[model samples]
Target: MAHITLPDESLPGIVGLFNFRPETTGALQLIAETLLRGESSLTSGERELIAAHVSYLNNCHFCHTSHASAAMAHLECDLSLIDDIKQGFNQIEISPKLRALLNIAGKVQKSGKEVKESDIEAAREQGATDREIHDAVLIAATFCMFNRYVDGLGTWAPQENEAYREMGQRMAFTGYVRYAEADL
Candidate 1:
């Protein structure tokens, strides 16, 4: 059960939070739009992977599954790579730049201050541009906040993986802007 009364119980996780704080949904969507969907050195899939990784680290099942599905949708390859990333990126077959960026993201999930100059340097050395590093950090930090927001509210989350895959297809097709209206 949710910690507060919402307009509907069917709206799961952050969707319920969005409906509860209807005013912030647009702004939140804008942020997500900018970070995950906007043009950047990082592909939409890569950005979503970073988000999914952070959610996994935070143990936020709703976000982990949602972003993982979205990541897979945006990618050209099979979903197993994403599954490996969620488990741990180190042993997975991913780019060195991505690995570096994931390292930084993991650090940020622990604490923003935990991210150091060395981390930034490492990413750059691995071919991550300044913009990529910035975006990765932002994505990590944002997801951490988002994860807490959902869990802190004791929001209901669907356990079924199929729901997440459906959500991913819709999100990949339409983006976050439409989600608030269609779902909430």
Candidate 2:
């Protein structure tokens, strides 16, 4: 059950919240589309991974699972990769640039102040451009707020992975703008 009576209680996580306040959905969806689905040096998968990582750190189950599935869809990989990310990036075979960005994201999850000059240098050394680093930080910071929004409202999330997988496919293929437009 949610903390308040949403317009569609059956809808899970942020979707239900979006229904509760239709006016805000466009802006939220635009942010998501631009960050996750927009053109950038970072692939959609990498951005989704950063989102999943921040959600995981926040212990926001809905955000974590949904974004993880999206990441899986973009990467065309299995759950094991998501597991590797959750376990920590050190042992994974991901690109050094991604790992460095993830490190920056993890620090952002803890506190904006936690990110250091050395972290930026390390990411730069790994060939992360200023834009990529900026995106990573913004994604991390945004997801932190988003995670809190979902969890704070006591929105319910489906436990089954299949539900998230379906959502991931839709998000990966259609993107957020289309969904947001439909809602308007």
Candidate 3:
């Protein structure tokens, strides 16, 4: 159970649904879908990885578990890689560009002021376009806000692995932004 009462359907909004209101939940849901869940120039798996890493740094268990599951589904990798990423993607076998992006994301999670020019230069050297770097920073910064929101409110997470797996599978297709079909 959540620390505060909220409608079941609006639970996914995390902090945005704290007041048990509809308008705030709807708006936040739209942003989550468009930014985190939708197709972007960056791969879904990579974006989810960024989100998970930032959440991990922020110590937001709900975001970490949820996005980690989504990343696993999209990357088609074993759970070990997820653990590896949670530990330190810096040593993981991802592309240099991705490593650079993850580095930038890490800084964003720590503090936006800490993101240095050297980070950009490293990513640029790895063939990351400015847009990719920009997106990475944005994803990291946004996830920091999200992590605080979920943790601050003490949002309840679904306890079962099956539920997260099913959500991950569905999100690999539908993304974070799209609302469930009427039948759902």
Shift in Å, residue 117, candidate 2? 0.3
Q: Which residue pairs does candidate 1 place in steric collision?
A: none
Worst 10 residues of 2 by lDDT: 175-184
- Give lDDT tens digits, candidate 2, residues 1-184: 9999998899999999987887887889889999999989999998998999999999998899889888889888775565666688644457999989999999999999999999999999999999999999999999999999999999999986666888988888788874545565
Candidate 3, 1-184: lDDT as tens digits = 5566666644553643644764455555665666666657788888888888888888877788778778888888755555676678744457889889999999998899999999999999999998899889988988888887787777767654455676677666776544443312
Which candidate leads the pack in lDDT? 2
Candidate 1, residues 1-184, lDDT tens digits: the string is 8999988888898888887776788888878888998889888888888999999999898998888888878875454555676568644457889989999999999999999999999998998888899899999999999999989989888876667887886666578884554453
lDDT (Cα atoms) of all candidates against the true structure:
0.84, 0.89, 0.75
Models 1 onward score TM values of 0.90, 0.93, 0.83
Off by over 4 Å in 2: 90-92, 179-184
Residue 107 in candidate 2 has what lDDT? 98
Best TM-score goes to which candidate? Answer: 2
Off by over 4 Å in 1: 77-82, 90-93, 179-184
| Candidate RMSDs in order | 3.0, 2.0, 3.9
The positional error of residue 99 in candidate 2, measured at the CA in angstroms, is 0.4
lDDT agreement of model 1 with the native: 0.84
